[model samples]
Target: MQHDIAYDTAAGSQSITRAIGRVISPIAFLPADAAEFFTPVNTNKNWLSGEGKRLFDLAIALPLLIVLAPLLAAIALAVRLETKGPALFRQTRSGMCGRPFKIFKFRTMTVQEDGASVVQAREADPRVTRLGAFLRRYSLDELPQLLNVILGDMSLVGPRPHAMAHDDFYQSRISEYRHRFAAKPGMTGWAQVNGLRGPTPALEQMTSRVSHDVFYVRRASFSFDLKVLLSTPIEIIRPRNAV
Candidate 1:
């Protein structure tokens, strides 16, 4: 049950033609919205569509590291002075093709801990510090992920990466959740910009996020990535339904 659809773009255009090849597993039999949409991918041996995305990610991320160096350094210093723990937080996150990679972020919490399971932080959570609150509010906490993008563990735009525990928890609850991994996880994404950011308290919220994630997969392109990037600042400035 695999198919590939390629959308033709203008000549010399740098748009991205998104595709997905479903890899069925016993775990993928969980329930999800019947209204979900998926654009199949051509699994033919001759296809070479992935190179465009990889090239684009590398090009964008390398320049961003240089461009944002000052801001990143300032944020790192701020987190260090405001917290007693390390400045950068690295944690394993599920990424493209269900592979694992360590994601980087500025530590916004007083204490950092890792376990078999992870929990979404809610508003007024005691673990969050005053500076952490500001960082989370404006997404300054995510600055370190620019390095993740540079490292090819993430992209400038796509679905936000989730904790391994959260991914496992939601896989049983939302069938389409795994589809998000069809592409690289992002620093910001359609879900975050369209009001899916922060703590997700219910299955519906997760469903909404997955919906946008899949949508971005189906309609992804360089221009679309730019659109998401442009919208992210607004999302942070006036965060709605965020934790």
Candidate 2:
């Protein structure tokens, strides 16, 4: 099999094999001069690596899980009692380098309603249950994805993963869409914080969101991620464009 290497950094350039399997660090990519700016992380599957990312994800997610466990339980019970299906809904989402992983989220609709490219959820969609509507409004429905963050399928802050069907469409419509896979998908992302969540009927909306997603991929860092996470709760409380 052929592996694709997309390296962007001051380290000139070199190719490594999948079998070689070396872990590259942040210092290898960022130069001292541009460290203050949003230094693009090296994200080639080989040239840039996933070792640090996976470790960081686990470190953050485990503590969040332990802290949020009780709240998660209450939300799960609310979802179950308010809806007929399982409390958690799992779907195959595109992850780092386009790998697929089952993303977990609290069920927000009365029905499963997944298939080959379904419609994006809209405000007042009849599929949403009462509690589900509240959950969606406050972004409580997404709490279960902390599990995915812990499992390494996602990060606390990165490009937001789309439904596989949405991925197929956006990958074609937006050139930068595929570039989002350059990093691990996140539970929430740069786009979502800026009112990019909910139904996007226009291609330009997806285009804008994808552009931000790709931008985050090229400019992610520990402090940047922390800022995004810190703002998420406030954003959820007063979501500007939530469905």
Candidate 3:
């Protein structure tokens, strides 16, 4: 079964509707409290929601988007000149409560795969274009996700959204995996700041990332989100595990 729900965007004047498929029932494994967070009736009353996380997301994202407009345009032009596809890449990513949302990013690969058998990118994957390599290296490709942050499909600080394929694969491997979706996805997350960014080619690596994500869900707060935000620039400038 599938259902469509309207989520508020940063503007708050308009909303975008997304269809969430029932490929994976998050309620089956999510904690009762966590599961309730996604319910329509409980959506606007959660810890993060009630504590002004959405306001914070807009406060930061809106300005960043405006200030970075020129740079974003430059990058978009570069991507277009360097590649033959759209400047932005869109893929379905599992959001809070296992709902799927279309995530936007700067196209960084020759092939855009978003299916059950999507392939994870390796360090020197040939599918990554020359310019794409640089973009991925500095995490420039992820800048477009600020829109997702503004779109209410994500937050400024929360668990990172994995591809639907990765979500399906990992949920089966880790019993508590779905619990990470208790909070909305983020542009930069606890796992990313804690050196868990980039491709998780191994189950162990992914498990470690999931651990941090779940921890953030359990310990999410305004101050903690600020800490993650402050630490993010450092991580971006001096990327560790990022590919």
Candidate 4:
């Protein structure tokens, strides 16, 4: 019962026609009211919406990718060498307007579980490789998402994306959860920079995280994004709840 994503070890995009017959079709489980959050509540003039945001994303993302190309390649090689699986991991995540897109990361686990019941990695999950732990801790595993940014599937700053399975499970329980989908998911976000990283198994933890996410959705602007970018390095240095 895999939901939106069906991993092809040999990756290729099937037509929208083929996808229906092959992978279990994508579905929209988000509440209709949640769509309202997609528009910022503030009346302030903001360039980080519409075409302006996309341009901003490309401006930052392209240069970062060029500078970090060698390191990204080294990570990919190391991931493949460490595990008997593909170097990259991709899973369908709910994007802006609740559209599903495959989010990419350097594979950090021995298992490639992208199905309905994909499990979150624990603090010392056995699935994580030795190198994988270091990458997750330092957030190196997320570098591939620079490509996501370049491709317009993500942003340089916004709410963090979650597995679609988790989104389906939590959307009903946590009212503010799907509000995070108001904007494109990001490599680093308001919640992540605020020390909300790692697994959120508890109801309270998830709720608190959603609060930050909802705040970002309402208050997003050029300055706010810069603040998240500046604060991210410190969180990387002294990560709270990092696994």
TM-score of each: 0.79, 0.78, 0.83, 0.83
**Worst 10 contiguous positions by lDDT, candidate 3:** 14-23
Give per-residue lDDT, candidate 3, residue 30.
38
Q: How many clashes show up in model 3?
A: 0
TM-score between candidate 3 and the true structure: 0.83
RMSD of each: 9.6, 8.6, 9.5, 11.3
Off by over 4 Å in 3: 1-24, 27-34, 37-45
lDDT of 4 by residue, 3-41 (tens): 334554224444542443232222345443334434344
Clashes of each: 3, 0, 0, 0
How far residue 45's Cα lies from its native spot in candidate 3, in Å, is 7.5
Winner by lDDT between candidate 2 and candidate 1:
1
Whole-model lDDT, model 3: 0.79
- lDDT value for candidate 1? 0.72
Candidate 1 per-residue lDDT, tens place, 1-243, comes to 122223233421323212122332122332222112123322321111256666777787788778889988898888888868788988888776666789988898876665576767898989988888888888878877877877777878878988877877887788777667666789989999998888988899889999899888767776787788889888888977654
Tell me the tens digit of each residue's lDDT in model 2 across 1-243: 122323332223333322112222112232222222222344333212346656767787899889999999998888778757799988877776567778888888866645575677887899888888888888888888888887666788888888888877776666556566667778888998888888888899889988888677776776667778888888998977676
lDDT of each: 0.72, 0.71, 0.79, 0.78
In candidate 3, the residue pairs with backbone N, CA or C atoms under 3 Å apart (3 or more residues apart, or in different chains) clash, namely none
